[model samples]
Target chain A: MANPAYVAVDWGTSSFRLWLIGKDDSILGESRSNEGMTTAAKTGFAEVLASHLAKVNAPENLPVIICGMAGAKQGWIEAGYIDVPASLSSILAGAVAVPGQRRDVRILPGLAQRDQARPDVMRGEETQLLGALGPGSTGSQAVCMPGTHSKWVHVADGRVTAFSSFMTGELFDAISKHTILSHAVAGADQSPADEAAFESAIKAAYEQPAMATNLFFTARSGQLLHGLTAAAAQAKISGTLIGLEIAGAMTNAGSGVSITLVAAGRLQGLYEAAFKALSLSHNTIDADTAVRGGLAAAAKAIWPN
Target chain B: MANPAYVAVDWGTSSFRLWLIGKDDSILGESRSNEGMTTAAKTGFAEVLASHLAKVNAPENLPVIICGMAGAKQGWIEAGYIDVPASLSSILAGAVAVPGQRRDVRILPGLAQRDQARPDVMRGEETQLLGALGPGSTGSQAVCMPGTHSKWVHVADGRVTAFSSFMTGELFDAISKHTILSHAVAGADQSPADEAAFESAIKAAYEQPAMATNLFFTARSGQLLHGLTAAAAQAKISGTLIGLEIAGAMTNAGSGVSITLVAAGRLQGLYEAAFKALSLSHNTIDADTAVRGGLAAAAKAIWPN
Candidate 1:
């Protein structure tokens, strides 16, 4: 068995994942839990980390490298942010040390675009960008990271030129549960997936993004008038939001810019479908691999052999 | 006091308003309560109406004309809908009577655009359109009725050509109370209103409607980086949603289409500000006057002297 060298942790707002990296760069052990920053803030970040470390039988003196919300102002310690346009390598340099710990611990700083007009910030996704594009990546690209707050970062010659966050996923959840559309999508979970409805919505929204809220209303109206199924209604909503987001993201990206999607599971599928429906070609990178790779890059940078 | 001729009630999803109409069509007495369709649905709609009528000292034999959600499927009775392209007079002709009532009680039918691609329905706003544009009105006009589900109807020669429903007001409520923007907008009600921020957001969203969700995120980013006040944050959200709605509403309207705003109080002010910021010329009509006008028309048609 390869000897465990260091621990790589990705602690987000509501989730925690730890990987015990071997000396040869293999994952010797792993742990995951819902005790993310929100939960750890109440239960104690140190205790949470210690328990996860123990679960993986991490060596007491083993160094730990972390990324994501754990380094936020309300996290274990404020790692701060490296304002862009900045080189990906700058994130490694901006890592802040967690004080008074027996073992060395460092959390990677996030990226902030402080444009007065288009101010934006990102945390864990910075590390994912680091892994997805690497520190020395070149050429212009639009990198999309789909989630609760989907992010589209425009990179030029390995530097983040600008990025925008779309409240697509969160809006979907809120609109579905809190709006009248809830009834239109009540039994969606149990119904068959409606790919055609989703594609149609994506095209409609992409073509006429201004009509987004009106298009959302059609979910209920369609059900009332056209007997639109619950699944179709749900699909329409997901597609509309995704389509609106893509339109917004593409506004800043120069024509013919390469598109790379970083996502996994359901989000991965949905975004891919959206891109296809819009006739846009794109590449995909497994989100887990990208984030883990990012944590690894940070780990190696902090503790050079 | 002039003899009471009839009663006009605008019973919405969450509100109830009754006005005693005199023989001269003046408002002789008025009563208002939160006993709208939802509340009255559980607590006997007839009893609720009787109490409000008693408060206004309504005569037992005096007829009543109602509009809005009281005509919905879940309300007192199913008043159904009048499908458009329709004449405004058809709404008056389509009033459904409540059986077994001692006094005449008629609930006006709503308007439904049963387009396969963009199906839409409006319960109360149809009446507002009728009152705003009148039965014999001519020329093309875009009638904007701002509310929880704002309806923008395109009227030509006293006929309802088509309409779109934007979930602006409801979305504003949900997003403000249910999303991350909630934190950004906390204490906004107590803070001084920010007209500059509101106008700026209106212009931004109106110009680039695709960037709406991104603009919404600026509420938080602005506060984090620029120290934007809670009121400004709240204003930004409101402006973005309203701007998006206007942009969408204007799409179906002809280039020279006259804009008529039917709203009252705060909504009127906000929409007026939005229109002014967009440099669009529009005439305003009081919402109360419009619905009452619609109900009066219905009453006159149903019970002639």
Candidate 2:
């Protein structure tokens, strides 16, 4: 028999990322591509994988542990999800077995909270969240993972009990770029006036949650009455959206549990502002690290003696 | 006021429509453009107006009636909605008297459904619906106005008291192009297959009201197992959204009130299917007639005793 190698994959809507891990759990190489689960079909998935692996010097025959939307119905292979009180070991154990090239390939199941208001679902991220907390992670913790559909995951005693996904980024884009409000929001030209407007907009969203609809008017009224530049008004609009997101998500977390934000780049700055607005204590972690760390923890679980 | 010529403009999110109507209620000429309210503000309102009027052989100082989003907060000028129990005459009376245009301009105020969920607001379309009802429009009636944010309005005694906005069209687009459900749908194309898929989807939404989220999975399953094409699936997705919309908005109409569908072109067909699922009787009015009808009604109100 050939020596077994470890592979970790985070496949999402817009991109595919893979990591080749050694026997001792060190990442030998990692790769990513724009060919997300949505764009790539079953046949195209192979090419995307090969293209990504070629960049990172990874062997094709390595055993792979997959997570995220890759296993979704549209994904390469539909890796379904498990339910609440989900254990890291239980999920790793329930891995949907998929055929691979001379390697034991497995897809991690996502988690669904059917009892919630929206019956929210999480795929690759839940496993990554689990992997971040490690094999024996216990107690109540709130994890904020922000993106187009930002998720607030509640992990209780090494199990994911519930989570909610907010369409913050998508809503912001639609309302800003697609609706009448788009008239007020200018693009990413660096301006001091724009930054201040953005901050003020955020403040508005946080202050009067019910008044979101009303505040949108101020974007133009601000320009009309007070001579707010379009860019500045745009920022105010952006702030209102992010602020509402923070206010809405924070209610569930309460002030009790510890909060960890799993984000990267631009989203990190927004999360920092949101957390501060809600008066919640928070620690930040890189998006990739959480995924890698979560995968490492999952590795410990399936291999735990 | 040399010869006092008149005009009517219907402005929306994506398109601008204008009709040169005489005082005796005759359409002398009409004009349209992709230059909607959102785009024109950047280049100044007067420039866009002149550009549109350039197509018409009318004098610059013609009296103009404007509607739709052009009167929105971010629009050309902020026009307030006249509350319910208020006649079209009352609303025309409340129209923001923007002093001296390149023409004499009167922006028809939109309608406001107060103290409800999100404080519902409608502009140009409401007046269009009123126009469709005609100058002699009296008593109770329901109108289905379809677009990105489709609105179902119920009018009693010539006043709009209750109406609901459904993001059905936008939801269809979002689920088709953005959500995990994207794989379930293909782009819009062709007709026969669209009809079959759409009918089935409307039925599904009608039958299972609570299982909207669950039902989406069938898009992929239907395609994979039942050989549903991407375009067919797309049509079904649209059908489901509109069906859900009808189910929600048509609850109060029952058999008591008359249903007037104020849609033009492609949407009237979709609205028909939506009604079919609910087994409801309705009348369809096309865009041009509806616009002309609406304009004539508004013109009456502007010159009302």
Candidate 3:
């Protein structure tokens, strides 16, 4: 195996992923855990990193590049933010080094849209955007990075003009586990998904985003009146949220704006299904790849070989 | 005091309210508790009723007329539902009697809009509608009953034409307590409300209802970037939900439709603020009076003494 060149970490609110990269720009080893910023904050961040680095058998002198909530004020160290409208490469200059560490560990800054009327922020997605679309990429694009807090970025050329975060995924989790709809979706995850119900919900919510809340109610009502299954009920909740997100994202992007969906695993499948249901054409980029690409860019810029 | 004529109870999912009515239609005594449908279902609805009846010192022969989730499938008795395009008075004909009760006791049926595409059901609000608009009221009117699940009823010439239920209050609660915005609204309820923030959010949501979810995120982002107060964050959440509800309610009800706001206390204050912010003219009716009025009409219709 090629000797490890550097370590790249994507530390989110509830998940932690570390990748050991080779000198030839290939992944040499990987480490994954639930000890994200939330957990790491409780159990020392340095201790968590040390354990993960040991697991991956990374070199003692390897430098590290970090992104996501690890850069939050509440995270490992306050990396702060790069406010828009800023060039994608501007983020590279804002990386903050963690003091008192032997290894040259650095955390990348996030992006913040500070318009008083529509203030928004993203902790780790700036790297994903950088990875999906290179620092010097051209053209106007609508990029969607879906997760607990799904972000939609509108880019004009290489500059991120504006972005909005929708509390879709988090709301879904909260509603499914805490609300009356929880009863409607009991055991839904154990069963096969109801794609038909999902598509119908996506279309309805996208067309009438104003009725998003009412649409969520139908998850229970549909089960009461139409004998809808638990799977279908869950699908309705998920679809309504995603559809509302798509509608909000499309509002200022004008007609037929090219969509670049940056997602992975289950979320990617759901968004693709949503786009297909709405007859929307879009390109897909692996979120893991994008984040890794972003971390690699930051690493190369910080330590040119 | 005059002998108790009838007992009125507005039993909901989480609350129970009882009023002992005298022969002259005056409230002889009253009782309130948290033993609503959920608690009643577990501890026994008959026992819960007996405790409340004892507290109010009702006459042994006094008949009870109940409305709300007490008549739900999971309640004391299944009162079923009055399907819409139903007349305001149609609810009276569907009351189901509790078989084992010593005193004459009946629970009013709810309303169900079975449009498969937009299925909806209400257990308690139908009576509020009947009470607020009356069985013989004339002309078109839009009634907004704000609650955990806010109901918007479109009544035309005393007949219930259509309605929609927005998950406004519930969403506000869930978002405030369960989401990241919870931090932003920690001391909101204890502090004086920030009306300006509430009005600003309401206007923004009303203008772009599609951006409802995005608007919710601003609650947290605003706090992070703009030093927003806890009261302001709570107000923003409240205003967004209410504003989205108003927008959805108005979509089908043409321009300048007269609104009747049926609410009580804090909810009444919040909604009144919302209407004022939007510059929408509306008449207000106390929710207590509306539910009582509805039960009275039902009592008179059932027992024409």
Candidate 4:
């Protein structure tokens, strides 16, 4: 194998992950750290990155393939978003050949939708979508990445079509901890929407004619004088909010259409649950391997011998 | 003149106020502190009263009449609540006389509709309602005490006919500070409601087919992509929430009835503006003298000789 020469880094707003591989697509070494795009500015990126290579026993001269928010304007190097109706090669707006570096570094460009209607923008996830689709992976598909600012990406014919972001996690945290429901909830860290309370709250939120603003007070007042349990209050808030999230995302992704859930770990289950709750058919795209697949594809295109 | 007759104490959830009056209904002295029912332990009532007395210059002996949350089950002395079909005088379920006290220390009973059809209860504010409807006061009127735990009391024939609590302020704070709209608003002090935004949001909330949950996310998405201002977002939240509050309160307070907007300050003005924005008719009731009116009424009731 030719001197295990390339690396892939998926750096984002709040996280930084790195992977190293050789010519034959075999893993040579891997390193993932917490010094994401946000913190790297305060602590020099080069210094943190230098220490990362030293610990991993990987040479500093390894050609690096980077995707995600690392190319953000606030990131280490600004790799802007690629406009719509553009391919991976021609759409590489943020990808830059970093000069004066010992190893070749090519950053992947994020996607942007300048459609006068919606006009939403997203970064980092496009490359993953590209990888999920594979070299031959093409045609229209909706990709749902569950997160704090969850994104629903529409891709087809080898390019990003549109995207929309939802502040689901932040909303869940707010309603649960800051709202009147806070008085109703006994504790946090409760989970699994399959619970009786969770199911009940979801059903109530979905079926009740009352608005959320109207129903919210019932959580606290119901507990105060009417005796609603804290756990049940929490479940009501979670169910109501997650139900709203599903509705919002479905509006963005279009109903009764085929969509792919690009999520991994616990988040994968949540997206699946939301889809199931909403009765939407979706195929799960392994988030972990999708990035690796994209990086592998990028290596083939850029470092081809 | 009879010996003072009685001291009337309006001891609420978060506050304590006392009046020492003679049989002729003249105020010899008065005192107040933050030893509210919620903050004080069950055994600390006597001490709180004593501490307030120590700070005031008073006559040798005077009968003391206490009302509000001080009579709650968890209060220093549990005066308990009188059942419905309750008259002001009938509200005197049983006055708890303090042990070894020089004079009568009657802690008045609150009203309870608990375990009833609506299952609601009121700890304090009964005295305020009675005092407002005292012989010296005018015809049947509605008194609105807006706060974290706001109460709207209806007074008729010198009695509190009905009342309802609106969790408006808490809901507003929760939705604004904790929800998706937080992104749109950087930070804002309590200002008069933005009329344009308020009117629009209220209209949207009332007219929209779906509930508050369906409407809230737009506050952020509208701003991020649609360019809605932070202040506008805040107003949108306030309008949507206040509309819901009005809707909720209306459920209890039957419609087409005359509304008394007991407003005195800027905050009151904001509420009035919101009410007016919705084309609702209201007569302003000055809150400045509402408490004093309550105080005077209690003194006269016990001083009759």
Candidate 5:
């Protein structure tokens, strides 16, 4: 096993992942848990970190760099925000130290778009953008980091000029569980996803973005009229949200700006399919890699090995 | 009070409203309760109807004409649907009777748009449409009936050409109660609604319907960045949904179709403000009056005096 030099953590609202890095910039050990900021707030952030560190057998003196909601006002410590238009590298300079820690623990700041009409914020995704695009990247790009609150950041000359956060993922969860559509999507998790239904919905919503909510109603109506499967119903919902998001995000970016989808697992496949359905050319980046790389950047910047 | 001719009930999923009509076509008595189809299903629809009838002091042998979810499959009787493109009078013709009742009890059938790509169904709003635009109307009109599932019906030459249902109200409720925006709108019901914030949101969403979900997030981000009040957050949510609905509904109608807003109370005010904000000319109709008018039309058709 390599000697640990620093720890990188992505502490989100409901998820926590940490990587112990060797001095050679290689991973020595890793730990993950559901003990994110929301849980750690009640159980003690220090205690949660200590347990994870022990699990990975990290050294006592090794410094730690964290990003995401842990730096939020309600999280471990408020690291604040870097307002756009901001250079990706500016995030490192705004990192706030968590006080009263034996091992130097720092949390990275989020990014905020202060436009009165379109006020938006992102905690973890700024780091993801930083990692995905790197510093001093050229050309205009629309970087999509899809999650509970999907973020579309417009980067021009390595500077985030503007961004919008769409409530696509969270809205899906709420609509599926709390609305009449719940009945339509019941038993969907047990069945295989209806890819055809998903793709169709993607095109429908993308072409008619104004009919997004109306499209959502089709999930139930589709079932009632056409005997649509639960999986198909769920697919329709997922597709409508993703398609509407793409439509909105694309509108925010300049004409012919390349899209870089930052996602992993299920979300990545869904978005890729959606992009393909709309005939929008795009590239993909693993979300986990991006976040970890972002954390690594912050770690190297802070530790200065 | 005038002699009770018939009972008119708008029995929905979560609400029940009753109006006793006189022989001279006037409302002789009225009754309302939270005992809609859901409650009536468990407590006995017959009993619930009987209770409301008793409260209204209806005659023992007075017949009943019911609309809304009471006619749904899960309601008192399966009144079924009158598939479109349908005539306004077709709904009254499709009414299904509840068997074994001493007096005639008929539940009006709903309207179903069976388009494979955009399948839709409306339980009670068809009656609202029938009343808002009488059976012998002229020209094209887009009738907006805002509620849990806002219905937009296209009426052409006294015929129901097409319609779409936007899950505006239900989405607003689910997003506010089950999502992160819940925190933003906490205590909003206790505060006076922020009219300015609502109007601004209406304009924003109307101009950029693709950014509907993004606008929803502004409720929280707006509060976090601009110190927006709970009332403002609530207003933003309401406005975004209504605005998105209007945009989608308008798109479904033909050019220069006059907008008839059939709504009452708070929803009516929100939508009127939304229309005014967008500078869209529209006429308002009392929803209660429309439903009753539709029911009266149905009664005359069923048991002509």
Candidate 6:
């Protein structure tokens, strides 16, 4: 086995992932847990990090590079933000060191668009963007990072020109679980996927984005009037939200920028299907790979051997 | 007090209001309670009705006319629906009587838009439409009834042509209480109103309804970047949802249709402000009066002197 060079951690609001990178730029060990910023804040960030490190059998002297909510004001330490329009490489220089530690531990700062009209902030996704496009990518691109808070970033010539965050996944959860539509989507997880319903919903919402909340109502009305299945109702909701997000993102992205989607598992499939339904061509990058690559870049920048 | 002729009840999902009417079309007594359909469903709808009826001093022979969720499948009894495009007078004739009630009790049927593409159902709003427009009214009208599930109805030549339900109020409740935006709007109810924030949100959302979810995020980002007050955050949410609703409603109503707003209290003020912001010419009708007028019309038709 190659000697471990350093440790990389992605500590989010509710999740934590660690990787031990070999000197040869290979993955030597890994650890994953639900002890994210929220949990660590209460359980003690240092204790959580030590336990995860122990599980990975990381060397006692190994330095650590961290990204995401661990750097948030409410996290282990306030790493602050890097204001846009900023170069992807500036992220490496903005890493804040955890004080009085046995070994050096750094947390990367998030990106913030402080424009009064469209103020926006992103933490872990900045790293994902860095890894996906690299620090010196050369073209105009609309990169979509879909999750609880989906981010649509417009990058021009290696700089993040603008970005917007849509509460798509969170809204979906709220609407489905907390609104009247909850009854319309109950037991959808056990049913067959409704591709036709989803495609039709995407088309409708894309065409008339203003009718989003109205479109959400169709989940219940469709069931009442047309005997729409629970699965179909769920598909309608997911499609409408995704379609509305795409429409909003496209308006900000302009006409000629190429689209890049960074997502994994279910969100990736859902977004890919939405883009296909809307007839929008796009490329995909695995989210896990992108974030890991981003952490690796930060580690290398901080500890060049 | 004049002798009671009949009882009229507006029973909704979470609220109940009852009025005792005299032979001369005067209100003799009134009662209000929070024991709406949901609570009544669990605690016994019949007992709830009796208690409210007793409070209003409704006589044993006085017939009761009811509307709203009390007529839903999950309410006191299923009053069913009158499919649209329907005539306003048809609702008056479709009241379903409680089979075993000692007093002559009837629940008005809701309107169902059974269009295969956009199926929708409304329980109590049809009565409000009837009262607001009457059975003999004329011309194109776009009636906006804002609430937890706001209803937008298009009536032409005294006929209900089309209608839609937007989950605006319910969404506001959910997003404020269950999403990340909750933190941005905590203690908003106790703070001063932010009319400027509200108007700006309305205009922005009216212009680009697709950006709603993104706009919702501004509550948090604005707070972080601009020190926006909790009240402003709340107002922004209200304006965005209402603006999206208005835009969608207008699309269904077409151009040059006169807008009639039937709402009471806070929602009325918010929607009126939105209309003013959008420069939409509209007339306001007190929602309480409209529903009472509707129930009275139903009572008069059912039991002539």
Over the stretch B1-305, how does candidate 2's per-residue lDDT look in tens digits? 22324777887766888877765666777788888876886776667777777787767667677777778787888887776645655665667756656556777778765542124567777677766775456878888888877777887776666766665665556566665446556454633256776777777655543333334544544554456678776776677667666655655465667898988767877788678766788888776677666655665566553
Q: What is the per-residue lDDT of model 6 for residues B1-305, given as tens digits with 9 covering 90 to 100?
A: 66778899999999999999888878899999999999999999899999988887678888999999999988999999999999999999999999888989999999999887788999999999899888888998999999988999999899998899999989999999999999999998922299999999999888899899999999999998889899999999988998899888888887688999999988888888899999999999999899999999999899977
lDDT (Cα, tens digit) per residue for candidate 1, span B1-305: 88999999999999999999999999999999999999999999999999999999999999999999999989999999999999999999999999999999999999999999999999988888788778999988999999899999998899999999999999998999999999999988832299998999999998899999999999998988889889999999999999999998887785578999999989999999999999899999999999999988989999989
lDDT measured at residue A112 in model 4 versus the true structure, 0 to 100: 62
Against the true structure, candidate 6 reaches a TM-score of 0.98
What is every candidate's alpha-carbon RMSD to the true fold? 1.2, 8.3, 1.3, 6.2, 1.4, 1.2
Superposition error at A25 for model 6 (Å): 1.4
Candidate 5 wrong stretches, greater than 4 Å:
A190-192, B190-192
Please count the clashing residue pairs in each candidate, in the order shown: 0, 9, 0, 4, 0, 0
Which is better, 1 or 6, measured by DockQ? 1
Give candidate 2's total backbone clashes: 9
- Of models 1 and 5, which has the larger DockQ? 1
User: How does candidate 3 score on lDDT?
Assistant: 0.92
TM-score of chain A of each: 0.98, 0.88, 0.98, 0.85, 0.98, 0.98
Q: Given candidate 6, what's the lDDT at residue A29?
A: 91
Estimate every model's Cα lDDT from 0 to 1. Answer: 0.92, 0.67, 0.92, 0.64, 0.90, 0.92
TM-score for each predicted model, relative to the true structure? 0.99, 0.61, 0.98, 0.70, 0.98, 0.98
How does the DockQ of candidate 5 come out?
A: 0.88
Residue B132, model 1: lDDT of 79
Candidate 4 similarity to native, TM-score: 0.70
Local error of candidate 4 at residue B246 (angstroms)? 5.0
Q: After superposition, how far is residue A304 of candidate 2 from its true place, in Å?
A: 10
Query: For candidate 5, what is the TM-score?
Result: 0.98
Q: Judge candidate 1 at residue A298 and give its lDDT.
A: 84
Q: Write the per-residue lDDT of candidate 5 for residues A253-290, one digit (tens) a residue.
A: 85598999999998888888888888889999999899
DockQ-superior candidate, 5 or 6 = 5
Best of the two (1, 5) by TM-score: 1
TM value for model 1: 0.99
What lDDT is obtained when candidate 5 is compared to the true structure? 0.90
